[model samples]
Target: MSDLFDLIIPPNPPREVMADGAMLLRGAALPYETDILTAIQTIATRSPFRHMVTPGGYVMSVAMTNCGAAGWVTDRTGYRYDALDPESGQPWPVMPASFLDLAVSAATEAGYPDFMPDACLINRYEPGARLSLHQDKNERDFANPIVSVSLGLPATFQFGGLKRNDPVRKFALRHGDVAVWGGPSRLRYHGVPKLKDGEHGTVGRMRLNLTFRGAL
Candidate 1:
């Protein structure tokens, strides 16, 4: 059978507002799915995905890797961006042009016209994987929007206010969807709930998220 992507992702994807500065562009990345997936595979072959450890000594549930001028990493020392992959002692793989184009286009659509991402953090989530509520504050500049592209199984996304106790709005992030948040919502707390079991035609039994940011 075909991937059935055409049935899931409409030609005119709607942009749903999540907050003052956040939005969900449904099926925004559908057209470039094949090319984006190819780039991810190539990047993984070089840097590979691994569960990172937090400074508190807890192992993260999500497996991650990256590409571009810098890569986000966490260890006993602390959470921060590193120009070189700790595992390889070399700079992370260069960001693919396909990826850059997708990020820039998505950001522009989200109202951030001058967004130029320096880091592409690729996260892989398996069944039962969960990401706790956290702010994306490691980036040096908050003016650039965070462009997150979803691939594979659908999962519940959490978007909340600046404080941890703020009420969170939950929504499903389906395959090929792109989420963007910046400006007033740049430092907002957000995360994904535990992933459920499922198989996607393009990405199989797991979810792949490409989060582009200005890490440098």
Candidate 2:
């Protein structure tokens, strides 16, 4: 696929296999792109995005916030999901209907039906920003799959095996692409390489990721 053509106007993306238990639904989130961005804006107004500090004392390059019953957070205290925003001292913003609908639709398309994610972690990445490989182990259950929606600039998504040293596969994820992993691939390690400089018409010079998980 031509990256240039995909950047401008993508053909309706079809469901493709990324791994044994992972599926990539290309352009699945296009219909909800507008609503999702609007919802992100609304969520940010309430909880806001901040570059969180990891337990190791390193500041993350990706700015993050959340909307749902709980929000994923990290600091010197270690990583965990909290019901309230540490900054606001109030419950994280409620997950919007549009967000819930899109997530469920994408998840269903990827063969995971009835994916009711209680937490939506929003990540913003600019040039030079990256996410090291990690697993979503904070969740209580691995039965539920992870449904992630990508928007704005393109990114290099890395997926590896359960062990950190396991061989990694790279996937080019563009706006509107949704990746869902569960079952055999639930404990896979994944991350994003540093984003290259690019300007997206709607999201500007950065990329936004909406990662939904059952973090109860």
Candidate 3:
């Protein structure tokens, strides 16, 4: 004897989904998405996002910026974390409290408590922009988990095995989804495919990703 509305609604609440050692917290960031976006704008104002060139002398399609004690950067010297912005010659903008809280909360929910990320990398992806499969190993420690939050346009996330050639599983990452990876799967290859054409009210034709890491 259930009502019509009850019959159409899901009985259980959304929960975290595990992929190997990685955990996907669906819709976990929805509540703080607006705040996160505001923080991004503020951070961008201090440190404008720009497309960085790889050591191989190729310009990246994804424009990126960072905020925290340490920021990831690349150039002829290769990938590494720096305290000062190479572009501005000043220290990277401070990590927003909202960004830190969301990252810590997501990691805690994924079973890694007391997570403190020293770096928050913000990546902006537009239509036709993509990131190839790669591991997050630039950090000094592999024990710390990487928490990534997604906002705006939907994109297909590729989570692969330890090796680049290993089989990959595609996950549709929508707005407000948070993905955490550590432990045994810390070195697994992961990347996003080319974004499709779409216009989100807030982000327009772009997808913003916040990846928190312990880079010190």
lDDT of 2 by residue, 106-131 (tens): 88877789789999999999999999
The CA lDDT at 11 in model 1 is: 55
Q: Is candidate 1 or candidate 3 better by lDDT?
A: 1
Backbone collisions counted per model: 0, 0, 0
* Reference-based TM-score of each model: 0.94, 0.94, 0.93
- Could you list the CA RMSD of all candidates, in the order they appear? 4.4, 4.6, 2.6
The best-first sequence of candidates by lDDT reads 1, 2, 3
Give the range of the ten consecutive residues with the poorest summed lDDT in model 3: 10-19
- lDDT for model 3 comes to 0.91
Off by over 4 Å in 3: 1-13
- List ranges where model 1 is wrong by over 4 Å: 1-11
Residues 101-147, candidate 1: write the lDDT tens digits: 88999899989999999999999999999999999999999888899
Error of 2 at 49 (Å): 0.6
